[model samples]
Target: MVSDRRYCRWPRSSRERTCISSIGPLLQPSSDALEKQFDSWQLRITPVDYLLGVADLTGELMRMCINSVGNGDIDTPFEVSQFLRQVYDGFSFIGNTGPYEVSKKLYTLKQSLAKVENACYALKVRGSEIPKHMLADVFSVKTEMIDQEDGIS
Candidate 1:
C-alpha cells in the first residue's frame, strides 16, 4: 500500500539537513523536532551563529508588535512581551561572554527590544482610550518624526 503521508523519508544528505536546520527557531519547533534534526544531522550548531540568529529574532518581534498594535491585537503584544523578556534574560546572562560580533548584534537587539516594549506599553496604556481604526492607522504613517533627527523621514 502506498502511504499518502508526507515526509515519508528524510533528506538524503547532511547538506540538505544543514539547510533545513538553518531555518532557526522562528517557527518555534518543538523539542522533538529539534531532537530529530540533531539526530538526523549529527551536527552541532555554532554558538556565534546561533546567537546571531537569536539576535535576528528581535527585528521580527518588533514588526510583530507593530502589526499587533495596528490590528488591535491585545493578546499578541503581551505574549511577545513575555517572549522578549525571556530572550533578554538569556542575553543578559551570556551577553558578555560572546565575541565582538555578538556585541554589535546585542546592541541592535536591545534597540529592537526597546521599540517593541514601547509599542506594547502604548497598546496596553492607550488601547482602550484610542479607537480601533485610529490605532490601526497609527502604523500607516509614511513620515517618521523629522524633528527627532533620526533621518527616518
Candidate 2:
C-alpha cells in the first residue's frame, strides 16, 4: 500500500529547492494586484507656462513703472520698486536665469528704484509733490542708460 502525501518526505536537492521557491510565489494571488490597476497623473501647468507668466508679470510691472514716472505719482515709484524686488525673488527660486545675470539685473533695478524713491522723498520733504508730467523725466531712461550714465564701466 502506498502512503498519499502532498509534500516530499526527503530534503529537496538544491536545484529542486531553487526551482520550487521561485515558482511557489507566482502560484499565489497577491492582495495588491498592481498589474491590474491603472491611474493617470498630469501637471495643470507646465514649466513653460510658469516661465511665460513670470515674463508677462515682469513686462506689466515695467509698463507700470513707465506710466508712474510719466504721471508723476511718487507712490508708484515705490510700488514699482517693490514689484521688481518681488519678481527678482520669485525668479531666484525658479532659477530660470543664471545667478550672476539675475543678480546684476536685480541690483541695477534696485539702485534705480532707490534713486527714484530718494528723489520723491526729497521733493516731498521740500514741501512739493512730483508733477504727473514729470514722471517721464523721473523714470525716462532705461536701466542700462542709467548704469552707463553713472559710469558703471
- Say which candidate scores most in TM-score: 1
Looking at model 1, report the run of 10 residues with the lowest lDDT sum. Answer: 1-10
Residue 101 lDDT in candidate 1: 76
lDDT of 1: 0.59
Q: What is the TM-score of each predicted model, taking all chains together? A: 0.63, 0.42
TM-score of 2: 0.42
- Tens digits of per-residue lDDT, candidate 2, 1-153, equal 001111222222323322112223224443455633643222244455444444444545555555655655556555555556666666657463554544444554455455555444544563155455654654444444656767775
Model 1, 33-112: lDDT tens digits are 76777654333446786677666765666676678777767676666666677787778777767788777777666666
TM-score, cand. 1 vs. native: 0.63
Model 2's alpha-carbon lDDT is 0.47
Q: Give the clashing pairs for model 1.
A: none
In candidate 2, stretches whose alpha carbon ends up further than 4 angstroms from where it belongs are: 1-44, 96-132, 142-144, 147-153
Q: For model 1, what is the alpha-carbon lDDT of residue 124?
A: 72
